[model samples]
Target chain A: MTWLRLALANLRAAPLTSLVNAALLALGTASIVLLLLIGEQFSSTLARDARSIDLVVGAKGSPVQLVLSSVYHADVPTGNIVKADADRWAADPRVAHAVPLSLGDSYRGFRIVGTTTDYPALYAAQLASGRFWEAPMEAVAGAAAAREAGLVQDRRFAGAHGLVDGGHEHAGQPYRIVGVLQPTGTVLDRLILTSLDSVWNLHGEHESAHDNHEHDHDQNPEDEHDHGEAHEHDHADAHDDARENTSMLIRYASPLAATTLPRQINTESQLQAAAPAFEVTRLLNLVGLGLDGLRAFAGVLILTAGFSVFAALYGALKARRYDLAMLRCLGATRTELLWSLLLEGLMLAALGAVLGLALGHGTMELIGRWLAASRGVSATGWVWLPTESWLLLGLLVIGVLAAALPAWQAYRADVARTLAG
Target chain B: MTVLQIDNLGFSYGQRTVLRLDTLTLNEGDTCAVIGPSGCGKTTLLHLIAGLLQPAQGSVAVCGQRLDALDASARDRFRGHHLGIVFQRLHLLPALDVLENLLLAQRLARVSPDAKDARRLLDALGVGEFARARPAQLSQGQAQRVAIARALVHRPALLLADEPTSSLDDDNAERAIDLLQDQARAVGAALLVVTHDRRIRGWLAREVQLEPPA
Candidate 1:
């Protein structure tokens, strides 16, 4: 109790210095917390997307990119496989279902994925308002896409030419928004989805009919009337054939078959297979390297904070010599004097740690909101209290040890000379 | 019987021998004034007697206990229980108020200082009104009074003051000397005041002069 009183007195003596030390410690703690939060959120998003698809088959690009385009709805497919090759895998008895994807054009920055209705069911996506697209040129927007583009059900918008910028004319074939998906807390929340036939017809129409000399091989001279009728139908459908797709998303029933099917398709067919889980895991490993570096930087910062604590306490000891001498003269034992100084440092560390925890949690909340608003992904704000508590305990122990050096010096001081001088 | 006995006591820092006293003794209730020129080791002798430093050669016995035979920690405990010390510069803790400073002495001796004892001590010293004032706020004379109160608070067997009158004028010095001696007597403790100043010699029952070290 006596030592506690002395410790409190010493802290009250130097309020500003104590506050500065606490602030430095808090800064280091906050950095570590921010790094951990970002890493966790990134990994969680990847894991969530991986769970949606058993396998993702796309062009032979980087496996990570394949997963990013197919499962995460980020990036574009390198190339597309023939629909005839996809039909062969779909007919297998071992295959429970196959969902093919065709991708090419985009609306703003969001990719427009042309796939079957099974895509929403595979992702367990729910409609926030209207139903999924059933006809060609009808569109289903992810929550992020709808909210960002200000598109509601039954609203129509012209498709952009390239994936990145500028709209192109399909003449009269504008896409109608038919559905808006509920927020899925995953990358799927930021995509525009439609049917494959819509994209294929648009591109076919964009091809000039003046180059129709090659079409005569598939026509017969005796079917002149039918050929004339077909040519009239092609002109009527010219607006629908203004756009073309470049990629497809394929899902296999079992992971074992999905793994084998992509290789088979690549060997005998013109398609490739990409596994979302493997690619996402690989991406996390790559990201983990950067997170590890950040953690190391935070460790160095904390070490510096410990050193600062040592220097601060050591400097304060010189000014406190007289006070210690007076205590000795007043009947304080050397041990009591040492304990008092140690207790003061411990108190400062404990207070700083508690404040740092609060600060870290608050920062996470702010970042979570910012990421949700700016990046279209919701960051989880679950408190990792156990890890944080352990960190604080370790810091407190280091701080106590740092303080012991000065306390030992005070204990060994020559009481009489200190008082006499 | 003597309360403090010093025989052939010697102390030095590095090659410079500061004190070499052949003999000194103080009986209970006796007040002795140690007088010498500047740098004459009066304070050194007082420190040796207070057990703050060990004599290089010879012995010091306080209340018939051999202080030189004890180790550092034991000597500190013995000092806290049996000795009162008033430093020349007062050395009051600047963080604590005047009353807290006095209470600190009693606390160090493991004796609880009740409000009554603290108020009584303050009233007797004529600094009762400044009990709550920090040491930095007190004037030199007032700080000196607070230091004296702290030294005597534990009712120690021996009281050692190092040049308590050096910083005060004659009038304040006389008042300080009277208060110190009276307080020591009232607490039934022997007083040893080390000073080069000769003006306060009248307050002591005996006078000893330390010669320059040979």
Candidate 2:
């Protein structure tokens, strides 16, 4: 108790030094914690969305963009894959299911993803209310989108022009909301899902709807479904059903299928195949490199903070030599004097660690709110990272190291000489 | 019973011998003063008896315990429990009030401090009203009084005051010496005052003079 009393009194005697050191420690802790939170959240989101998607088959443009658009539901489509080309891949024995998506419209910043029921089935998404879209001009909202729009069953609303909010509203064509999905913590949670037929009808690209329609059944010789659609309103069409789809998301039937399918499709046709696992890994590595550099920068800052704590305590010890001598004269042992300063350092760091954690998590919450509003993805930002304990331990070690030199000086204080004058 | 005993005691900083005493002894309830010329190591002799310095040649026995024979920690504990010290420039802790400074002595000695005793000592020294005042807030005389109270609060058997009157004015110096005598008599402790100041010489019944070594 006496040691504690003297230590606290000593620190109280120099409040400015204490506050400065504590502030430095807090800033160091906050930056490190913030980096960890954002890094973990972003990477895990990438990994989770990439896990089930095996490959994306799309037009011959950027494979990276095709993968990003199909798997993450972000970025513009890399032009359209012909319906026949998409159907040929979909009917392959090596492919488990090839879900088609027609994108390019949005309802309140949430991407209106025109996909078949198999797409929602791939995510195991269950409807929280109403039912999945089964007919043309019907949409089902994911949990996040439903919360944003707050639409009731059978509510009719027109979509916006582009893939985000604030686009000019398409007034003439309107779709009825049929259902809302439960939260899945996947890309599906941010989408307005519907059958691809709704997209074709919305764009007036369906067989009967296209102004100058043409059906080329000879193009898909292997597809049994196309045999009945041989007849064509064979006028020159500006935008036809043949060039309808944005991309096709492919799931392989087995591990063996991945070894040959991507290269086979890319080489044999004008379409490109991008495996989600490969593409997402490449993307994260690029992002991780930047984050690693930031972590290193944060490490340097923390080390500098440790040095700041050291310099402050050492300076205070020098100025308080008279008081330290008095303490020794009051029968405080050298060990007691040493421990008091060491405890001061630890206490400063602990205060900083706690305050910094709050600051970091609070900042993350603000970012989460902004992202949810802008991208419709509800970020789980308040994550207790597994590495948090290690980070805190490192901070404490820095604190101890900072105080050690000052404490040693305290231990060797010349009580007799200091009190002589 | 003798409270302090020294025989052939000496101390030095490196090669220069700072203090050497052939023999010095103080029994219980005795008051004595050591006066000397400047640089004759007046303060060093007081420090030797208080276990703040180990004699280079001989042992200092306080309360019949050989202070030089004990290890560092035990020597500190011995000093805490059995001796009180008052310095010329009073080193009162600025953070603690007058009462807490006195209580700090008892706490360091591993004894539960008696607030009543501390207050009574403060009252005896005429600084009882300022018990809650910090060292910086107190007048010089009042802070000196608190320093004396701090030394006496732990009920030590030996009180070593080094240059206790060096910085005080004539009247305050006389008053401080009188207070020390009264406190030592009341506690039944031996008092040793080391100073080169001549103003305190008339009040001392027994005195020893030290000259620098040739």
Candidate 3:
């Protein structure tokens, strides 16, 4: 009780230094917590979304790119495989179901994925409003896509080419929003879903108009057609191409299909097959390398903080030499003196650790709210506190050792000469 | 029985010998004053008796236990249990209040003195009103009294004072000497005061002067 009182009194005497130390510890702890939460959320989201699909078949490129484009709707596909090849793979005995996907268009920066109704059932997505697309030009919106673009059922928008800054209007092939999916806390929530025929038709119509413009220039050189005539020709061709299909999404009956089908397709046909689980593992490895680097950096920071604690206690000992000698004169044994100094440091570290925990949790909660609003993902904040407990315990141990070094020095001080001077 | 015994005790820092005492003994309840010129080893002899330092070629015994035979922690423990020390500069911990500073001594000695005893000790020292004030907030004479209160709080068997009157005027010095002596006599402890000042030598029961080393 006496030592505790002394420790508390010492802290109160130097509130500014204590506060500074606590703040630094809090900042480091908060960074570690935030990074851990975000990394866990990202990895778990990828794992959960990739669990349902056994294989993703798309154009030949990076397997990671294929999964990102076909399943997650994150990046553009390398190129398209013929719809005829997709129909052939669906007929294979090992295949459970096949859902075709066409990408390359966007609405307001969100990638528009042209996929079938089978995609929602495969991903186990629930419809929050209306129904899935039933027609060529109709679209189903993910929760994030709908909320971000303010697209309700029956609202129409002209799809653009690619996910770039500008857009080339689809002329007559305007898409009507038919359904909005409930938030799945995955990347799927940020994509626009529609029939693969829509994307293929949009591109096909684009190519036909290019040919028509050249034909018009060759045939009618003297009489120039008005803007309305050219626009009508583009629309007519767009409607005609809307019935043709593009690439397909495949789900295997077992894990063996992921290895067998992609290899078989690449060998037997022009189509490419991608395994989402395999690609996700590769992705995790990439992310893990970065996380390991950050962990090393955090290790250095904690080491520096430990040294700072040692330096602070050492300086305090020097400044308080007379006080220690006085205590020695007042019947305090060297052991008691040393223990009192050690207790002071332990108290400082414990207080800083507790404050760091609160600060980390508070910062995580703030970030979780912002992420939930902007990215439509509810980051789990509770998962980080347990890991932070280990960090706090480590800091406490370092603090004790740091304090002991100075206390030992005080124990060896010459009491009589120190008092005399 | 003698509470403290020093025989042929010699100590030095580097090449110079600062303290050389042929023989000294303090019986229980005796108040002895040690006076000397500047650079004389009066404080060093007190430190030797308090077990704060090792003697060069002789031995110091407090309460029948040889100081040289104990390890650092044991020596410290023995000092806390048996010796009370007052310094010329009045070393009270700046972080602790007057009462807390006094209580710290009892705590280090592991002596459980009650609040009533503390109050009585403070009252007897004439600084009871400053009990709650920090050492820095007290006047010089009040801090000196607090130091005296701290030194005697554990009821040690031997009390060592090193020029405790250096910061006090004649009147305060006389009062401090009387209070310290009265407290030592009340607790039945031997008092050894080392001082260069000669004003309060008559107050002690006996006086010893250290000449030059030769």
Candidate 4:
């Protein structure tokens, strides 16, 4: 404690140099922590939303974009797959459940998804207020969409002609909100859910198209089109179906489905099937490299801060060498002089670490709030990683190493010659 | 009472012998001045007695304890408890106040720090009010007095001052020598002053002269 006072006095003597070193260290630490926070939140959210679904069959295009669009609702859809084709998968012995999504319109930056009651069941999205829609043009608002857009029962709003906001509004055919979903903490929280007929009608398609979607979506026991070929079922009707271009979601019934299903659909059919897990992994691998680059850049900044501390102490020692010599004469051991320098370096690092951690978390929180407001995703929080703790320890080690040369110099200084001058 | 003694003392800087004192002694409470030329090794002889430098061929025994037989650390401990040295330059720590400067010496010597003794010595030197002021805040004379107070803080048996009056004018120089002798006598310590200034020669009854080394 006695030595600490002396070290603090020395630090206080040169305030500007100490502050600059600390600020640089804080900047480096903040960057490292922020990077980890972003990486963890991003990968976890993707993994969380893609857990149950196995394959997404869509129009032939980018597989990653298919998963990103259908599974995560972050990109443009790969067009549409036939609703009957989705039903054929749903009826397949190997398939557990198939959910179809019709995308291409949004309200205030939130996507309005036209899906079945199974969509709400998939995400466990219970209605927080009012009932789930049963009729065309009646919509259930997602928690985030409701809260952000101030959506309420009886409120009518036109959806623009894109997955995201601001393409062109279908102002004449506005849909009324009947329900608001409880916060499910998934991508479902950011969508407005309705029946597929509402979507076709809103786009001003033929009225019979809405009746066709509603008709073909259920069990058509007495159908005139499929009386002879009962086994081929929805597949023959879906070939001429206009909804063939729309994207469809598929869930695997067994592990065998993963190996056989997507490959068969991609190779043998006009549509493509992309696994969410596989595509999300590939997507993150590409993004991780960029994040790693950013983290490495932050590491370099911390290294430079270490060098600055070393230079500051070495330079200051030239002037204070006499003080050390005098302390020796006053009966202070050489080791005490050395420790003073080491302790000073440690003090600077401690200040920087504390300040850096605060800055790092504070910066993350600011970005998180912005993301929630702008992107409708909460990606920042007070999450501590073991690596961050290790990073702090590494910083302290750097501080000690930075002080070694200066402290050793102080220890080995020629006291007789120093005082003689 | 204990006294300072040196026999066949010799100290060298590389090939050149800087100090060689065949015989030197000071009894208890005695006041003496060592007068010498610039290259006569007066300071070197003082360092030999203080156990700061090793003599190549002689024994330095202070109060019957052979300093030459002690190892570096032992010699340092022996010097700390038995000898007080005041350097030519006032090498007070700029970081500490005047009182802390004196207290630090006692602390480093591994002796119980007595604030009362330190304050009393500072009071005797007329720098009592500057006890809390840093060396940077003090004038040359005040810092010099503080340095003297630091040396006498532990009240060692032998007090050594190496050209302590060299930077002072005649009036201040005489006053400084008087103050050093007065404090040494009060503490029952033998005072030995090494100086190039001949003015202080008249103040001391006993004087030892060191001729320039060959």
Candidate 5:
């Protein structure tokens, strides 16, 4: 038998120890691999979805919440900003491009976004079939939205009132699906796009009813009489600029707009401008602490695995001294014996590496499926980050280092003394 | 043809000499016993012949190649091809089966695996039925037969056995010596048995005695 075969046989002879060491290494490797998968998918998905849009302008609230609602459709909007104010900003010379987002409804938990064709253009989306919506009540379904909700071209479906399912459905005001978008691998894939008037007209009567009902309730006199007039005055101001959008996604015309525009909007208007790049960086930084903690835990596990491998080899070597001498008597060179021991360590590491990678990717795919089901944002396991290769390299190094002492002992062993003893 | 020649060989550990031999020669198909009490360096003589140690003085040659003139690795290669040693303990690797033990011997000797020859050798030693049996599963006699088969599988120029029959009864000891002589003659190898067991002296025609270090 070759030295490698001998090494493998030796490992098989101690199946439990070999398996435990391999499994420990696998656990550490899988953890690191999973972390890389999630971290890379999160950042890359965020980057891809937010590439075109520079800033999100919305009703005064947290900039992060505005970006989440308007750009990602992940959270509820901070509230609505007047469409007239957004229109004036879009007409500004510094704004290169703008898309109005009138969000507030969902169909089967997928958001129905009121946007112009420019929204699809923002993601460079293309039609899978049919055409982009050209009129009110005509909708273009994103790929995921189309597939999930069964929104085939020419089909009509009404949306629920809120961002989530189980809300009141506007059954009478159903929209015709004019087109289905190809998968852009972006946030747009989870949205249904329509003319802004579709949202405004649909909410028109509902808004007035809600306003008057609140007005009557305020006049109840027992319910805080001091705010009754203030409530009515606020309703009148809302009616004066009745057309409103949840947010405006904007792209700057020049680098100067980056410096002045968000500050200008925040100070001069009743709106908050959130830079997607800045918000994304802040988001990653916020999540970085947890990622770092998991990374450190993975490092500790790997270190422990290395130590366990060393201990196992050292222990086994002590028991196998006679075997080594026997091999020497059988004509094996000292180097050959040394390599046999080294091969055992490397084989264990190799087994762990293979098992770890498969476990990591499989677990990530399961998580991706769950995330896709709930949030409409999936992190795929199919992606292989470059750092994963480095992970394998690190494991091999650990295997070698763990085996080094045992191999040296085997090499330096006095065969005659050992055999006689 | 002469298979082993030792002349004025000396070996030491630190400040003490362990072994000194004036001259000894053995030819192909020859059987000899180096007999002595314990600590008389009989095993050391086997080691020196196997090129497992560098002699401090004079020369030990196997198949006409001087072992002391070779580098460590070269000596290892020479020993692998020319020498087969059976330790007193019959140290068969527990991980390998009886058959794999023979195969491993061939592998370490850098000889191409001849499964037929290995199996035939095992059959010759009356351990053919235990070919697949692990060393731990074998009786002491069966393990000894397997160890002998492993040593002769590659057809070495010289076969060295250290206390091959010390653990056996008189009948088994005579049988062990007969097996060694027969196998060595079958492979045309010079046979040298190193033992403190005086019963072994009567079994072999040619004998040499090693006195304890003074």
Candidate 6:
């Protein structure tokens, strides 16, 4: 039998001690591996979703909320900005491209975002089939939204008035699906796109319906018909300043805009400008506090595991003293015995590392599925970080270090004295 | 040929002398017993001969190579190549089965394992059926036989047994002595048995007596 085989047999001799050592190491590794996976996936997905959009300009509110609502479409928009004001900023020399988004409607819990074609260009989203919307009532469905809502080209579906389900449905003003977008692995995958006029027309009808109810309280029902007609004309003649869009996604034309644009918009105008990069960093720092605690917890577990392995090996060494002597009598050199003990420690460590990585990835995949369902953000376990290789190397080093003392004792063991005793 | 020789061997623990011996020699295939009382250092003498201890003063040779002339590692190598030892307790590794214990001896001796030879040794020792049984699972007599098989598996030139039959009844002790001597003769190895049990003296042709120094 090989020395490694002997080491394995030795480990098997005390199943409980070996198992406890391996388990402690596995728990420590799993914690760190889980954190590494989730942290990397979270930040990368956040960064990918927020790419290209330098600043989000919207109604005055929390900068983080604005970024969340406008960039990720994961939350409700703070409020709306006047269409004319957003258009004026879109024309600014500092702005490379500005895509206006009008929110506040949904078809089956998937938001119906009324935006220009430049919005698709923002994500570089391409059509999977069919064509883009050419009219106010024509709509395009994102890949996830299309598959989830069973939307196809030429299918007609009326959007609800609110971003959630059970809102008042615009049954009379149904939209025709003109296209479906390919998956961009971004927030766009969860949205239905339409022209801005579709939102205006839909809400205009609701306002007129409210006006008709007021007429029923005072004037005759015949006046409601004429009043609705008048409201339509007023909507048609209304100045652009009176109309509003929810938020404007702005890209900087030059690096100088990064220094001046947000400050200029926040101070000179009635809009809030949130830089995605800055808000994301602040957001990460806040989450990082909790992550730091977990990291420290994992660190303690790993050190304790190292200690446990050492104790197990050292304890076993005491019991196996006579065995060592017998091996010496059988002509095993001190170095051979030493390496065998080290091999035992390394074997336990390798087992822990493999189990830990498998557990980490499995848990992350489950979490990713839940997040994809609850929030619109996509997080996946399929990604591997480079640092994990270092983690494996570090675990092996811990194995060798944990075995160092016991191996030294085995190396220096006095065979004859031990045998005589 | 002189398979074992010793001259003026002496060992001490600190200032206290543990053992002292005059000249002794055993030729190839010779059988002898070193009989003594408790604390007479018969076990220590066996250890010194096996290269497990460096004597304070002595010239010990096996196959005409002086042990003290070689480095520690070289001595270990020489012992592995030339000597086999059976202790009083028959220290078979509890982890390995009877067969694997013999295989372990060959491996530790840096020789390519000969499973056929190991099996044949076990069979000759009459513990062939217990080849796959763990040391813990075997009876004391069976374990002793397995230990004997392990010692002679590599066919060493010198065989050392310290108190090999001290724990057995007379009949078993005689059988154990007969097995050891017969195996030693088969392998052409000189056998040295150390024990405080004077009963073993009758089984060997030559006898040496050890006494605590005055």
Instruction: Please give the RMSD to the true structure for each candidate, in Å.
Output: 7.2, 4.9, 7.8, 4.5, 7.0, 5.8
lDDT of each: 0.76, 0.80, 0.76, 0.81, 0.86, 0.85
What digit string (tens of lDDT, one per residue) describes model 6 on residues A1-421? 3888898888888888888889999999989989999888878888988898999999999999999988888789999888666666777889888888889999999999988888888889999999887667789999889988989889999999888999999999899999999988888999999877677678756766333332232333232212112222323433434667899898889979989889988999999899999999999999999998998999799889989998889988898989888988888888888899899889889888888788888888888998777654578777778989999999988998899999999999888889878
Native-referenced DockQ of model 2: 0.61
What are the per-residue Cα lDDT tens digits for candidate 2 across B1-214? 9898888877788999888788888899888999998989887887788777778887789979998888988887778888888887888888788898989989987779889999999998899999888899998888888998998888889888988888888998898899998998888778999999988887866788887755
lDDT, candidate 4, A247-358, per-residue tens: 7677778889887888878787778889999999999999999999999999999999999999999999988987787666666666777888999999998888889889
Model 4 - which docking category?
acceptable
TM-score for candidate 3 (chain B): 0.95
Kindly report which residue stretches of model 5 are placed more than 4 angstroms away from their true locations once superposed. Answer: A126-140, A143-162, A165-183, A206-242, A252-270, A370-378, B14-16
TM-score of model 4 (CA atoms): 0.86
Tell me the spans in candidate 2 whose CA falls farther than 4 Å from its real position: A82-97, A107-109, A146-152, A159-172, A183-185, A202-244, A251-271, A373-375, B13-15, B202-205
Looking at model 5 chain A, report the run of 10 residues with the lowest lDDT sum. A223-232
lDDT of 3 by residue, B56-129 (tens): 97999998899889987778778888888887777687877878777778877779855667768889888898
lDDT of the structure predicted as candidate 2: 0.80
Kindly report which residue pairs in candidate 3 clash with one another.
A99-A249, A100-A248
Each candidate's TM vs. the true structure? 0.79, 0.87, 0.83, 0.86, 0.88, 0.90
* Candidate 3: residue A349 lDDT (0-100): 77
Model 4 residue A299 CA deviation in Å: 3.0
What is candidate 3's lDDT per residue for A47-144, written digit by digit as tens? 87776787877667787888887776677676776554566677687877777666788888888877766777766899999988755677889898
Q: Point out the worst 10-residue segment of candidate 4 chain B by lDDT.
A: B71-80
For candidate 5, write residues A200-266 as lDDT tens digits: 6578648764344334432442331121112223444553245678998898899789999999999
lDDT of 1 at B60: 95
Each model's DockQ score: 0.51, 0.61, 0.49, 0.37, 0.66, 0.65
Candidate ranking under TM-score, highest first, comes to 6, 5, 2, 4, 3, 1
Off by over 4 Å in 6: A205-238, A369-379
- DockQ order of candidates, top first: 5, 6, 2, 1, 3, 4
Retained native contacts per candidate, as fractions? 0.71, 0.62, 0.63, 0.21, 0.69, 0.62
